[model samples]
Target: MEADLPHLVAFMLGTGVRIGEALAVHWHEVDLEAGTVEITHTIARVRGEGLIRKVTKSRAGERLLHLPNWALAVLRARHAAGILNDPVFADTRGGYRDPSNTRRALRTALSPVGNTARRDLGLSLRTLRRETGMTRKQVANHLNWPQNRVELVETGRIKVDHELVRTLVATYNVDLEQFHGLLAQIHDAVQPAESDKLAWIRSHALRKTTATALDQAGHTARQIADQLGQAKVSITQDIYMGRQSANPAAAQALEHAFDDPDLL
Candidate 1:
């Protein structure tokens, strides 16, 4: 990352702002004099329509954020030459940047040698289901899961976990080669970008880092949660503050006990 890209990434890391919120920011929303930014809008890609400016995900997401010195400096430099209604981060055509394309750019910049195997696993699944004449409800019934679960998985709203992947593979009756190919594509799509020693860093990782740093600096969970625009402090504590346990001994013990042929 260079030029405005580094500053953009740093701004997100510093402020814990989501990429969509940051991309939707306009000069009017930023007060360089006050070192603050109002986050009221977010850019999202609607299915039929193109990228549309929408309200923040929740009321909490519409709160104001105090800019750190670095972020303030960035805004100050931009404000010197920016128009009132222009986006803080503009596209080549001087319009709002698409968050999805921004993510692709980040991936490409961090990894020059792009992964050729990358595929739209979610779209592929959706196409497969449609080709098989299966509605979301029918697929959910086959998988013994909620219809919303099928919808979310197909729409990429929910991450496809191992059990879900296995279930889909079985339901689709994919051959070995197709199964491995689909698995590879899903793995690439779901795994974070790991290039240039960034260590799987994504926009959300920066937000989590901000929350963790705040917690380490003796800030209360409620304060961190507020800064992160979370509805509850427990979410900040459990997910972003690194307070969740990661012990895998239970899984290992279960596998050992159940996988033994003698026990069976």
Candidate 2:
């Protein structure tokens, strides 16, 4: 999780800025005194130029965002650290962080399993979904796999390859951190399956759980959108440790919903 951009993740949740826009942020744009961060440019990968930080496409994309308290704290810490890099979120080498690598790192931080994937999606009868009271047949239907396949997976009669992992992710509707630790464990078919992380949560644990949790808490669609910086409601969900934005109700919802800090 530390290797991933937890701070940047927090900033995105608070500002609703696109990943590129967030990456392009310079020290000059972040006004901690004003509690604001301007979205002036977005980072793009040109064919030969590597990363190109350019002005936003339109005036709308160039809007200024107010920072929540927690997000401000994150910035303060960064500023106090006196990072030599121009970009607020720089790579380990103090240079522009590639969008692809950053995204991958964020996915990695998310624990795609939160370390729970080792069991949640592994061969275990006591997996997360089943422990939540979901029957094998129900899960099978969700995966569009034969019921026998679910049993096979649980019985350790078969290995869950990358395709199955992707299908499970898509079917379960979880983000990176939920499956964060899974990638390392995914290919380790020999790794013994223990308790399922999916076993812990209940009531639609998979499939838009993040957004649904926010909605149930009474956050508006717009707020959810801003929190995720996404137009789609299905995946609405961020963090300083980045701070949770109080102004936007979604930020508060996220703060309450995600148990793990990195999940934000």
Candidate 3:
């Protein structure tokens, strides 16, 4: 993950910025001396419009944010060698990084983190999809499944069954050897021991973790919401900060409250 993504994921976690917002940030927007970054633009893919840079989702999202020291250091080093007009995080061609490309990069980077079998299978499927220039919907249509089903399988949310494997093999025109290799990976990933490590890790988990940490550290919900560019504190509280238990004993308390000798 470190080698493939470099500092991109870390930058997003440290700042609690959305992936699009982080990708759209330019070197000129970073103030190393002030330890601040101006949140101005975000990258979005509009239907029939392609990738476009637009103002943030809301007025609150346009506010400037103070950077953490580590985030500041990253920008400082980049500023020392990077061009002002270029994106802080650039594509291979040294232009704005597309959010889709970033997601693909993340999937590749995380391929080795846990459950090697699942990761390998997911990466292989994703690679074939990209090579064929087929969208998830296109693949789903070919396989007679919903787009989310194709997405879930590729993201490791759904297990790769034999039927899906055969469909993918036929859809992508994989040879006999490749089919066998994929089958082997699917079999390995479904082993009881490997199942425990098969959890899917989404990129948004970083943002949620950051928000939860801030909430635990006594930052106001509104403050965290602002930093995350959320239009409402309720949104941040309900979504990001809700991932963890605010009080660990709440579960025990509920158990005790519902305790009944007859039921037991």
Candidate 4:
């Protein structure tokens, strides 16, 4: 029971559904055909009681979301194991899950995997979701939310979009699918390719040579500098690098100057 809490919480994390939303999720809210979940209400702790139904945090909070394949698998698996109906995560008494108990269960569940915070701490699971690159707004959009609601969710002070969440995951080269498959590949395949590196350097050299030739062709150093937006010393360094090539046109143009008084 305790060992399964993180797996339960992982569903919320993967989907970016709020804890309250996850707690309140019932069979009626899901549409297997459409692959979506309708956000209606949530279960929250108001007083000293266990779980109570409450209105969603915002009007934007009440929206529909397309369920990802990964999320659906977890949901389907849990449902198939007799976790359907009134409360998706019911306690042993067959009532709503207690928030305190849920926290303890989560702590216990995360321990075997070595992937949770201190049990006695004040950290909200939402913060943990963000740290783990999961959050409500992010999950909602992946499920195809209303345009107006999606806007509010992304830029809203309270929630962030799924794309933003994906962006965060991308920074770590993580993919939610199969968890760390893509991450492992990126880590393993990220060595610098010497051939590609040399190709890029050669391209830079050609560009430098072209720029210098054009610059030496009666163009002022400042004009060339303005064109490339580089320092004059940089131009000098390119010339020093032996990138200057003899052009027949430039030599022809210079040949006339060698015999003319105006060249002086």
Instruction: At residue 121, give the lDDT of candidate 1.
Output: 69
Global Cα lDDT for candidate 2: 0.61
Off by over 4 Å in 4: 48-50, 112-264
In terms of TM-score, which candidate is strongest? 3
* TM-score, candidate number 4: 0.39
In what order do the candidates fall by lDDT, top score first? 3, 1, 2, 4
Evaluated with lDDT, which candidate comes out highest? 3
Name the lDDT value of residue 196 in candidate 1: 27
**Whole-model lDDT values for every prediction:** 0.65, 0.61, 0.66, 0.46
Tens digits of per-residue lDDT, candidate 3, 69-110, equal: 555565676667653446778776677777887876575444
Candidate 1 residues 1-264, lDDT tens each? 232466577667656778898888888887777667787888999999989889977766777777666556667766665533478888867888889788756644444322332236667788777878878888889888965666556655444455566677567675525577677777775654333255367778778877776666666666666666665566546456542111122222223323433321
Worst 10 residues of 1 by lDDT: 244-253
Say which prediction, candidate 3 or candidate 4, comes out ahead on lDDT.
Answer: 3
Which scores higher on TM-score, 1 or 4?
1
CA RMSD for every model?
14.5, 13.6, 11.4, 28.4
Better of 1 and 2 by TM-score: 1
Assess candidate 2 and give its TM-score to the true structure: 0.51
